[model samples]
Target: MMKKLFLFFKALLTSLLLSACCELNTDNIVYIVSTNDMHANVLNHNKQIDLALISGLKKHYDALLFDAGDAVQGAPLAALSDGDDVISLMNAAGYDAMTLGNHEFDYGQNKLFEHAASANFLTLCSNVYKDKKPLLNNLNLPNEGRYAVFNKNGFKIGVFALTTVQTLQSTDYRLLNTLNFENEVKSAKKMLDLLRPLKLDAIILLAHLGCDDAPCTSKNLALALTGVYQDELDLIIDGHSHQEYVKHVNGITISQTGSRLKQVGLNVLNFKASEKPQVKSILLTYEDLLSKGIKPDAQTEELEQKFRHKQNKILQQEIISLPFTLYGGEQYGIDLSRVTETPAGDLAADAIMYALKTKISSNFLKFPAVAIQNGGNIRVNLGPGAVTYASTLYFEPFLNTLTSKLVSPKILYDIFEHSYRYLNNLSAAGTLQNIKDSGGFLQISGLKIILDPNSKPKVKAIFLDGETTALSRYDTKRKIILAGNDFILSGSDGYSILKDIPTLTEFSDEQDALISYLKHLKENDGFTQYLKAQGRISYTQLPKSVSAYVKIRNFHQQNKKLKFHCSVDGEKFLPCFADKNGLLKFELAPGDHILQIAEATQEIYLNTILGIGIKQGSNLSTIPAVELMPTKE
Candidate 1:
């Protein structure tokens, strides 16, 4: 009996040992870490996230790091070194591959070349060509825009990159002059043909085109990749729109890390290839969790801190502070043109536009009409106190340049229409009728005009160039100069109004122009009139909760000159419209509620418009403190 028991136990032990050994020899997993739209957040919180990832990755699998594109430009760091320091930091961080984002050309092609050459890792862009030859030709590196294949544990990983087609619009780098952004499908197909011969394991794409919930620059590329170009593409890491989402479309895994390197995208891919390499499964992981007691890798953090200190020093050299806090935002006030009144928006716009006019003055382009993209575009807003170099860099961090193209008047109107549509969708009040003395809406620059949200479908009048002209009466034949940042001119956010405009000339820089213009204008230290909104047209503010009963108490005409009526809602209230200053007060029941502001002139109403709801009988005496939430997530 004892001998039989021993034999049974010995056999069980052997079986267990065999199973354990087989597990140990199983195929190793390959981890690909990618980031995009870093936009100068090199020394940002994202750096900490990157450190945490390296520590975790080293313990589990073989890892390869990639920055899809837009590495420099858009932060104080990029502007400080003209991109060299960023390259150095990237090398220290152990980046294996990187591509150029459109903003990379902000300083022009020469600087871009310097950055590309300075980078320690493999710099690539299959589409960028120069002097009729591939940009990467003689550089001891592989040709531009070609995939670099890596062999790991018997699996071949082919990696490639693609930038947004719109990036070509800028002349900053002239990087695309000799190259063409061919159909992604065709390009990927050709690359696949070559990759297949290697009998590789997986194909990865580091795409810097923008992605969104709807089909956008990067999302379209993803579809083309999986559905048409190369359905076999194992994974696509995207950037551009500064959005985030991890999804599986048509068996192809797509993942994107939010902009500014707030987090890193990690995908652990399992594979098996007896014949053709096939992905068993792909798991999407992130470094955000590291904040919860997960310490970053000591070495990486130390290196990043060093770079950050250097970046801070460079950024602080030229920034200036303001004397007063900017108004508008979540509080009450007209949106468009309103930002111009604030020291923050007006000062920045004034500086930037003035720089352009001085630098690029010629017969063809006489006067420049500058547009300061709303508060949303102004990434950083300096407080009333001290403004440091870091603050300015954080605000105008994008390496956007003063680029211009000759656009037709018709196309120009289309651009306005596009902008108008976006504002409409956002429930933004454009004209004076739509403007509120306070609360959330689009913050605009330049023209002081009124938006009639209730007006029938067309633009009525436009006040600009020191003239208030009736837009509806005049023919659209007139042409005027319009200046703004690359995003607006690039026609991003559906503003295709300026897309078809031909290129007149490209300015080396508008920053200097803006600065010079401001200094010259402010020589006397006179009160330089900033842009302000004259609310002629306004969107109707509606109640948020429809389930609850809302009673309109009194209705009085506010802004006597504008003569616009605003409805007051309260159990017993005074229906007083705003005076020229746009102030109105009313009583309300004790509870949470929203004050709906609308245009009383036309029945066509704008909902959730503006105005602060009073909490019972509390705090109307204090002017109700207003605040804007932080832009960073």
Candidate 2:
């Protein structure tokens, strides 16, 4: 009788344990591992391997790994394999998911699709769409999904990803023409709503928007999605803008690891299946991980060594002696050459024109008038001595077509205006400033530009190549001026003024043009490169005077008389009136300024022709009408 009673109790306990579901689970745990903006530094970076061991993840909790984007656009290793090695390493490291960052599209859309398809883990994003249909799902990438759910001990955790909307501006605009990204705030709401009816215990949003991108960053995302208080989100993983922070905001936990495998984030999820989950996060910095005595991942280390050995064999082959140090990547580091000018900038612009002259019949528009290169086009710096193929290619990485078009002085003025427009600001784009605000800082080989921040026509004067026919009578001459480079000819990088210009012809790739020029220099013994200003480009303070043209549009139909006052440089408003054409025109002191116009209860910021500063003008100048919106509570 005693033995039968013991057996009956054991059977009942087994039954109770077997029937328990995720809906009534008593314990659940998992770990989230993420990397962002590695930029393919495979040989130099191997921290991800040790991070796994340092976190002690596999021992006590389930692990899920993810990458927030920008995995494969820089460094020679990534360039040679087009990210195949990156994919293999990520697979071996056991990444569970990833989302596309802007640089993923650097190799073009089709190749990017291939990279996404080839990955072992899911490539996720909730807002990318093509032809109004979802892109991540329609691409049919085997592991890709809009959102994912993982179950641990019968407890389900839902997750989704979002790329920055600025992606279109940040990536090659031409390649992503067919795709569109939605506003992040609205997209997040939609994703959460779709996952609401599921049996999820918590939701996690892994975002690439960070603290620097602004209005679209993680902090802003939290403000928009959760308002002043946290509601549905349990944790947020973020990347992009390359910052590091581990903090709890608005009752929600947020974490980010810096780029290039500099750090790894470990978020420990502590939960009961039926209640709101709690999160604890710790950042494993590179130094800290090293101090833990966690050995470098052997597999990744081997992979990196193989890549370096292969890459060095080709990259180190001597091409030519630099003679002098060539510098670039001044402001953004590994991107733009600089806002003003540099030796590397001169070399690139001169190389293009030199190649065209020697090649002949390269009439971009009846033979080119000038050769221009975007500063953002130059990458990395090279010191004096033997330069290798690998090093050369690293400096001039992206595959941009060499194209040209004829532009008028008026439009050319707009280009210069765009260049100097960033004179006052340095954060978002100290060098380039379109929506993405990059690569438009100009370095020219055929002309000189004099920019006066105080004038309406900021370009005070233009001088022909060799400094002949100095900007005198330049405005009077609208001679069809030829300029090169697809980034400019196609009107990217705040060059909207040239978008409509017809392409006369497209030639060899930019890299090839540079190589030809380098070889020609080698043959002629002209390797002692020299680029003095010769007054080609000058940066000066306030001009003698400045002018403004302002127009008011009544969208809400509140006023007709347009009664208003004007202010200069944030000063007190003085009484002002519109001209016969319903336009307000005025002049003020020239250096840097702020123009505001107020009528009745409404006020608007007036951006003049040629913007902020320009030489006074009235003919054919289109006044930029800035619309003012009401502030929200």
Candidate 3:
């Protein structure tokens, strides 16, 4: 009996040991480290995360490193080397893969392909195409592909990338006319169809679709696909809007690290045999890594020091001295260029005007000329004294050349309206509300204007350079030469109307123009003229009155009794009628107004239009026709 009992106990112990060993063999863990919108900040600044830190973290965790995009452009180092410097740092830090950001095209398509060829790691973007062929295939680059399969710890992970469609409007439109950016959702679906057949262990998406007001956001993409491919998609790494967040939607995880190396994203995926896999995302700051005793990788740190030494040699040289500081983002402790005019913006506009005044044609020189700079392009502040090339580069980094076009006063008014379209209104307590800042804000030279937010025409009055009378009274039909950077004049930043306008001339880049302007200032001793705001742009307390015209269209031509009514400043609807040609003319007060058309017997309103700007004492014959449809019973 003792021998039988011993045999049974031995068998049970052996069985338990075998089961434990099998469980250990099946369990697996994989780590993914991601960075996005680094903007060529390879070295740490203000304790922000840098490439050295990213490399160290990758080594500490034994993880795969990836960037979401916008890594190659923005700072002086990247601009000087045409993005080769940043690419070298990335290669040393051991990047596994990266998608394309809109700024990748800032240097043009040829240079973009060169960067892709030079990169050791995979550069994957599934949507961008030229001549109906994938960009990677067209370039014939072996290192660049639409999707790549990575093997980590015996697990096969498939990854693909999608570039934002906004690339058309965000980058140089003139240079990219042949390239086509496929729709994000459609391209994602096609990628899934291709990747799913491989039967990989996991599928990941590296997307530049931001989670902002733009269409085709990361959240929207996940929501659209998760309904059909819920079990297939594991994770989405996002960028482009510069937001930092990690949230799960429809059983899929999405993560993004904010711009300028503000944070690093870590995704951990655990897989077990005969069970569903689990993934969790965490955003780590530089402080977070320090508390955990992580150190920068020695090799990457050395490379960063080398690049810093090179940049400092050129950046430290003084160009000009200023008596007072010129501000772009410093006035409100944030970037207020898109919401209001700044001294830095004014300086940039004036510099462009100065550069083009001599280069333009003689016929255009005779007319009134003005320069406008987009708020997005005015990046940094100028110094109170000893402004260096570094400060100038930081102020305007994109190398955009000067462009000019002849435009009439009507087109000028349209431009002004578009600039203020994104302007936020005041709250009931008389405080300015949070503004949805646009890159299209026009910072001008050679003009002064009054704006009222509550009125249909926000621009109350416009005064030309050195003229006390408004431009409307002083030759409203006269043509003016409009000069600005090619980025804006090429129809970027919501200036679509400028796309078809023929270019009058092209001159030197923005940095050169500003440098020449500064040298002139030094020679002429004109620093005091730009010490503060020049009173070019100001907001008014009360709205201005104007003669407005509306073309009422009645689709039902048989209904002659249909009457039109107008409401000024949200008051009661007053009787309004249209002429035989459907043109309704009226005078508006200095406030918000509404125009409505309805059938009087049924009191059924057919259409209501609000905030249409019609200039006073101008030609009403040019007003565009508006068509309205009658409400069905």
Candidate 4:
């Protein structure tokens, strides 16, 4: 009996040990969702992202949502409330965590904190602090640089957040007075020390340092992360570079969904807690929860609608009567670039620039120049219709103030070098292409140059107050004052080509400028005028030589096998016109000639190559004789 009792107790002990070990091995599956660089479009896409998230919450009840900052500025709605309404919406969306993006400082920290009260999410950033406390108060949670721990099916997890150092460099709201972003990795280590004691299952770093594709942003930050004391950090949810990724680097998996609530980085990390912890498999996936078929949450939709009506009331008031529809007028197909003929772009730029000049005339600046961004940036097209204040506000919603800086001649040259990209593909052929590759540098109102499309960018001549002058005669010996918005002057378009420029010289508040300009118009006999291009630009072609074996294909598909036709001063040479199948061959000796390709029946000129060179060497060929569309004359 004693022997049997000993055996029974041993068996029972073994079974219990096995059962306890299996219980400890259970998983804690956590879904991490993150967003970054979301410039608040609260009334439009912001609401869209929120509704999409609410939809996500229904699907993944246990997922944690984090917004990586740059969330409150850029659009008019958020700017109007100074981010208070967006905070209310964010709280409604149940955001779990967030960090301040650079733009957050646009209004300064005091407003940010007041708005923070409106956020239901956990405000975090290991970098910035005031009086030894995180810049944001109510961080009752320990700041030991440790993670926020959550229990899931008997598993322990931790999450932390980081911001970029550039946040301090912005003049948005003057943060240099207090906080500073120390090296990200240094703070990460201090937090790791605190986390080490917890014996956590996995660590997640919510990063806001935007990454680039080449000299990667996240990868660069991750290199810093290698110095971190903890080995348990298995995942990094990154933002900043406004990029998308689903990959692992240096043993840690980093993921970021593209910005503006387009998608959320959804990651599933499997962990094993043993004598030593290890990550099994990290699967990254993006949930395009923002689809048409998916209905938005009823509660979120109701809140968005409430704000939409109020915003519409303010945006719907008529502001002006435009002579022609512009910014892609729906049925009218009007172009803003036709600003000379259509009063839309010209009128808007005039109003804004005039208001700014009037506001800042105390300085002896003369003949101010104003330039708007490219055509693609013009989102809405107006028609011969009553322009509403909302439409104007919506079209130019950034609310950017007018600013100027004294740029050195050398620096201005560098800036112009890059800005030539804008002039290279102008829609109007008659528009001056004479701007040397280096010439289109100046975005101004007091000058104009005629450009030939067929030739390189060499200024034919420039007109200043209707008097033509050779451009080469003018040099950068004198400083030319320029005016533009903060975004433009900042060289946002890789045109950091301007030098000797002050950071930001705010002259007139954007909204104030608009209002003042509008009132000025109401006072000045309703301001009637439009700008039109007053110059001729064309490409003259000359063929140097044409040898035997010159080949041509159908200019158009209809006459596929037709013989090719070449014209030298209106005289036909070659195997003449091809048949319906436009295919032609030519043989000729070296000579000066004009080559023109004409369609068989339409009688439209397909292409004219002036000054084309066929070397005296051997034979030459033109297999595909098609050409780009003609520029607007």
Candidate 5:
């Protein structure tokens, strides 16, 4: 009888213990959903996951939502509304907090403050300051602070934000001259010192610093704080490089979701009463959610559609017609604008020159006014037909004003050299990471050059606007005025050589300039001239009598037959075929020879222009295989 009583008590005790443990587990877990570098892609279109889906996830998981910045100023919606539409959507999506990205300041300081005032959540920025005070405080945003503490699931969570110091060079310096960005690591330590006193359960550093090459990056920040204040920082949500990663440095977690709503990040924290909390990071794509039977929130989707409908009325207005498409980088399966010259780039540069010529009738025009548009500024291709204001806005959306300066020929040489520096170090077998294109690559109007990538100085020769003769690198007789956007003229994108040069004239923004130029082309029937690349830039000086091998890979399995053409030493085009192993072998003469490969198949798109240099006896057998895209038909 006594043994039976004892067994009954033991069973009851076991049930009680399990119940307590389950309650503790339920109260201790916290969920955080994050996104970075969204770049104003609030809708679910063009392979981009929607902000409404993010809202659905947040509600379903009972999670906190935060953006790592660059949330504004890329699409026509943001450009037309100066980012108000994005903020409105973010507010509707239930953002808990966000940090400032470099592009956040694209519209200027007053607009930034206006955004902060309109935000339903906190705008946390610990690094940026002006006149020895936080920028928010200085700008009279007393309600928004550098750091905020939240009580979630019975635990106090501390969150602080940091913006990259590179913002000075990435943004208009004039707009940010008064502001100072603190060193990321130093600011992190300061934030830790302040947050630790409050005895928080977890601390997060929300940063716009990327994980790329760095004096300032989230990875560096993690490494820097690993030993000294390792226990102080629990997690870091990073942005600005448009890379996706979730890694641990020491005991702290660093996570980022790539740009344009490609993926949404989740950090799950499990806390206990006395021990260190455990953290786990995860990234989810739209497909992942769909497979799990998750649907976008109805309210958020309705709100997004309302905004879309309002914007489409203004954005759908037609601007001009085109005979053929102008190609930008990536859309045509090649990095045309950044690595080589494209017709779209040429048009952007010409627009600047045309705007300047029409705006100012000074001697600057007489002295060879050449315009150079940074390839990065030309965001998209124009059109094949019926281009709209929305399309043009997407093509150049930063809203940078036009500026011109008279610079020396030496400075001009430096500009061209700087543009080609990224290409000069490329290897025959370099991967995409190694062959990364520079944003500063110049797309020119009224200039031509022969670029020898393998030589000491990449700019082999430069020609004045209409002059057939090449200008000597040391020539000083002819004066030249350089016209471009304020971003490049003010020394952004490493064009410091052009900085501090007195401005000869200032014109309208880039989009306006492009519109005016397109209208002029329409009136003059010059659209046909822009249908193909103008050969404003050419590659030359390849090794003579050297053999090279080119390999091609077909991306589309539907296309079986393909034809190829080869131009050797800039000679007449000749038919070529790859061997059974799919290798095109080339033997060239010793002089400055140019070898080019063109596709003759209508079913496939040529993705790369393989320009290689080889030694006398060496064959470039290790060159990376080029990709070929097949048409849907």
Candidate 6:
């Protein structure tokens, strides 16, 4: 502890000694270097220091660096060192402080402690507590404080840190154990109350909460804080949700750097030690980093070289060649591989299913026609050229093993229903929870499941290997089926049903399985088609009403004279007219019925058959949902 204080003093003394030549102004300005969700990408970090050095700005301005979580876990380099290497690099980059990101615990509590203990910077978090004690204290590391006061030249700056409440859903519960993250908004307010009396020039919050629009986002915290102590709160730097934005609300400046070290959130304050503090924020892009004359730091280069040289032979080798690039897009701001079918996800699912079934040929386990994967499991997108082992490792670094189990067809339907709760979100709260449930969002390989967007938890139809099956058949005969993956099989996300399924066949690690599967396909010349978007999954919104509805083009509800007739099981056709709801409407016994609609001279003729039986409590969640469509479109 004394050594760190001595080093800090020495640096201060050195800066003071150089002040005559550099002439750093004490009363004019402060620059805050903010980074967030780096995820172990050191390529750009290598050039961060040069931003000040190359421009000779270091001599005039004091830079206070803070990372808003997620420095560990994600890239192969961090995974290779159990997160130790990134900490070393962060130290070399001159980080002053950082908050704990959820992924920092991916390697487990013990390793996380080791990294935190070794870091040159203080790991700050006001809301985290373990077993009635602060998490940092539980590890017996340094600080006995939540917020810190840093004196820059002649100005005093108060800084406190916080993380998102959704970290509970983003990480493994076991890793958390007794560690609890309080509501971020409450934590921020409490911290502000404590820091307000200090009379600091500026109060800064380093938060790992999501950006402006996401649930529990930092903007919510900013609004809550400034609303109580209006001008007292000056700036907020945030992360998580991996977004890029700079927002100002009620006089507080909020900024976030997107993931992968793409940019840095900047806060430049002009306080003359007498004037009202003025603050301005801007997100510096890669070009701006270079425009500022930043050059790569030599030590970071050497550290990166060490890791690459050690793993080069395997990491650089090509695994497979793809015909086209496969990418996953963000749905409602949360990236999901399961919201729709993607070529990359399909190939991954196919490879795993094929590997398990082929390796244990005709054993006791019966593999299902489709393979399942959580949307969150897939990380990287692959492309046209050769995909390397390192790229595959980066795509999926988690050590999730493939587990196979027999879930009755009934249970399988329940699993899909639970997974759909996120995809078919309606209310505001559900949409937010859906953002977290993206991890449990299921991606399939061999079935086309249609969804009704308007109805919550609706799976309109299950086209099993191109054969359409109504919800009634699945309810009648209960058949044992295959479903597993450590994420779902262990009931991690929200699937509590698979926790104790009787029979099971557990296989290799997820990355290893993918490696083996790709190799298996390559060896047999079956790799050509895996890169293209295969139509194994599909989605649709089926119209719903008291009776069968006539399909319209672009929902045109114009009052056009159209003749309508209805029949019950093709018994007889009866005349009908357009109701107030539009087109034509009718109700019959809860059985199969067909309705026909046509213009005066057969200009627009349509026939509708209600195939799916309307049973009590057998809608949406209880069973697969199907829409009533025309026999011929």
What lDDT is obtained when candidate 6 is compared to the true structure? 0.61
Model 3: residue 276 alpha-carbon error in angstroms: 4.7
Q: Which of candidates 4 and 6 reaches a greater TM-score?
A: 4
Clashes of each: 57, 10, 0, 40, 4, 3
Q: Encode model 4's per-residue lDDT on 1-633: one tens digit a residue.
A: 999999788566544532432222235445555666665654444234553344344345355666777678655456457767677777766677777766666666778777666666666777677776666645454453224676655567677777766554333323446776667766677777777898877777777765642122566656665554535567777765555666666767777666555555545544444433443222122223432133455666677777767667866766666543332212112232322112334444455457545644334455334333322223454434676657766555555545555544344334433444333432221222223222123323434544334434433444343445533433555444455655566556555554325432344335545555655775675543331211221222323323322233334634343444455334554446543433343443322122345532211111112112322234233222443233235
1-633: candidate 6 lDDT, tens digit per residue: 999999788656544433332234445677777888777765433344322231223222457888888887655566557778788877776678888876776677888888878988888888888887767775444444478788775779888888776666445455677888888777777888888788888888888886523347787776775456777778888886567877888788888877666766657777854455777776655655455554555665565566567656658878887644555434223353655455567777776677556544353444444568887777766655788878787666654546566665566677777876655432321111123345676777656666654575476666556566644425635444454466677677878887666424444346656777777777888754643345454344223333433333322333343445544333456776653433344554321232333322111111111122222232322111112233332
Instruction: Give candidate 2's whole-model lDDT.
Output: 0.62
TM-score, structure 2 vs. true: 0.53
Rank by lDDT, highest first.
5, 3, 2, 6, 1, 4
> Each prediction's Cα lDDT score?
0.50, 0.62, 0.74, 0.50, 0.74, 0.61
TM-score of each: 0.59, 0.53, 0.58, 0.57, 0.59, 0.53
User: Candidate 2's error at 148, in angstroms?
Assistant: 1.2
* Candidate 1: residue 303 lDDT (0-100): 69
Question: In lDDT terms, which candidate is top?
Answer: 5
Clashes of 6: 3
Please identify which of the two predictions, 1 or 3, would achieve the higher lDDT against the true structure.
3
What tens digits encode model 2's per-residue C-alpha lDDT throughout 1-633? 999999788556434422332112235655666677676654553334332342233222346777788787655566667667777767655677788877777667778778777887778888888778777665675324688887756668888888888665444356677898988888888888888888588788888787663348777777776642257888888876556777777666888877666677767666744478778666665554445444555565566677678877867777788644555544222233445555577778888777555543433236327778887778775546787777777778764556556666666666777876654421111111222234677878788887654456567777666655554434535664454676667677778877766554444346656766777878998655432222246645434444655555442343334445776544688987765555666775422233566543333222221242221355424453444344344
- The candidate 1 region of ten consecutive residues with least summed lDDT is 600-609
Among all windows of ten consecutive residues in candidate 5, which has the lowest summed lDDT?
600-609
Looking at candidate 6, what is the lDDT of residue 32?
76
